[model samples]
Target: MNKSLLKLTFTFVALLFGLNTFAQDDFQGKAYYMSKTTMDMDQWGGREMSPDQKKRIEERMKSFLEKEYILTFNKSESIYKEDEKLEAPGSGRGWGGFASSFTGGPKYKNVKDQELLQDQEFFGKQFLIKDALKPLEWKMGTETKQIGQYTCFKATATKVVDEFDWRSMRRRQPPPKKKDSSETGDSAKADSDDPMNEIEVPKTIEVVAWYTPQIPINQGPDDYWGLPGLILEVNADRTTILCTKIVMNPEEKEDIDKPKKGDEVTQAEYNDIVTKKMTEMREMYSGRGRRN
Candidate 1:
């Protein structure tokens, strides 16, 4: 073959190889996910403020999810109600019925959003397949049981801690001024810059996922994708997200949408809110029984 013809042939071969590789690794399936995490606070830590706490927690989770992933069919409704009018044997007005009963259908969060959460300007984007194989070189550990459906593979990731860093891209917080000052003064602001006090990094986060090659879509329940099949489980840091139910091509067809335009906020802002709430929760529990 001539030089130009040989070059063209090689390029075409490479393109075909890339497409086939992607198709082979893709797993397309539906998953019902539930994220269970240890409460940042104790029982009395705002989580026990009647049934209202549940809704608040759900909202917080939703907001956190908004940082990454495009949610689909995300709906919730109260299913349980109490008739407060009924008189109890000992209570005077009787206890009001709790509205805790609730059920919602499957919610789809696209893998693309996961990267966006790490950085906002990266919206409506996709990551290269090779990026998924980056080193830390964490190992893919043993398989464990999940939802009694399939054995899960474990993956670990870690990063060196960076102090004084900010999440301005992940949230919608106001920009920091060159000479910003709060009523508390510089000392308070300085304290927030210390990363050692916040937590350590190279922190090990464990992820468990079940990939079934039967489906050929490159996607998972949450921010997890790139596996050979659908990811049925994913656990990161204090959170454990799992697939409770799986429906392979259900009768209904629907398109999932990403959080866009007005729905999106700056990353810094979201982090500020989360950090403030976390601090409040920590203080409430840590200062219990200690009078001011």
Candidate 2:
């Protein structure tokens, strides 16, 4: 090659590298998401309740069912958290307390490093769940839709539901009636009295996600990620998380750092811990009921 041509090629490559670095350093975005989950009232004994009772139950559950979250992202890192707001008086009673105990706090993801760090406060104990990012095998489709000013493409995946994920939990169906008396032993009666035996979670759930190439960041709310673009909407089983607003390169940027203030544990280990604690509570409640 001629000397001039070689020099020009080198210059072009250097310019490209510099521009990529600059873009990574200066690019930041904040995505606001509104999440809502629908529950089958009949499955939760709502059918037995009066109309007024059902309405009150729904009102209390609204705090958990409908929520807003913020996802702040830069090139390879992102932090997702619920948007904090004051609860109405008496909204945090009964089931709210149980839900809050199992709910996780801010979650931080490092896409480049393939790391996930989440803060979870189960009951009164705090745990830092440090684990590899769970990759979803997404089947991308040619379908397209417009979300605000951005065009989004469709993708779907089947996710194995976590054992302790309450979002997929449902009341266990009763066993079929047995004509013989042998099936209704004392052991079976004891099991029926334990409330914990009534709850069950699905093994897997189908997730449909909508991602936009305009953002060009592989990030999403909750545990959803690994797309070619930023995910704008997610339909996972009973829950829907939709992006409501986007702020690009905002002047005030929040730090995307891993949570450090908790006993470190892997995702599986944390699940086990929660499971053990729940079992203990269940046993205690059963003992008290037997005593009465």
Candidate 1 C-alpha error for residue 262, in Å: 1.5
Model 1: per-residue Cα lDDT over 46-123, one tens digit each? 555666776555454442322222222211100111112334344321111110111111222333333332222222
Give the TM-scores of the predictions, in the order they appear.
0.40, 0.90
The C-alpha lDDT values of all candidates are: 0.38, 0.86
| Highest-TM-score candidate | 2
Error of 1 at 108 (Å): 7.8
Q: Cα lDDT of model 2 overall? A: 0.86
What is residue 138's positional error in candidate 2, in angstroms? 0.3
Listed per model in order, the count of residue pairs whose N, CA or C atoms clash below 3 Å is 12, 0
- For residue 196, give model 2's deviation from the true position in Å: 1.5
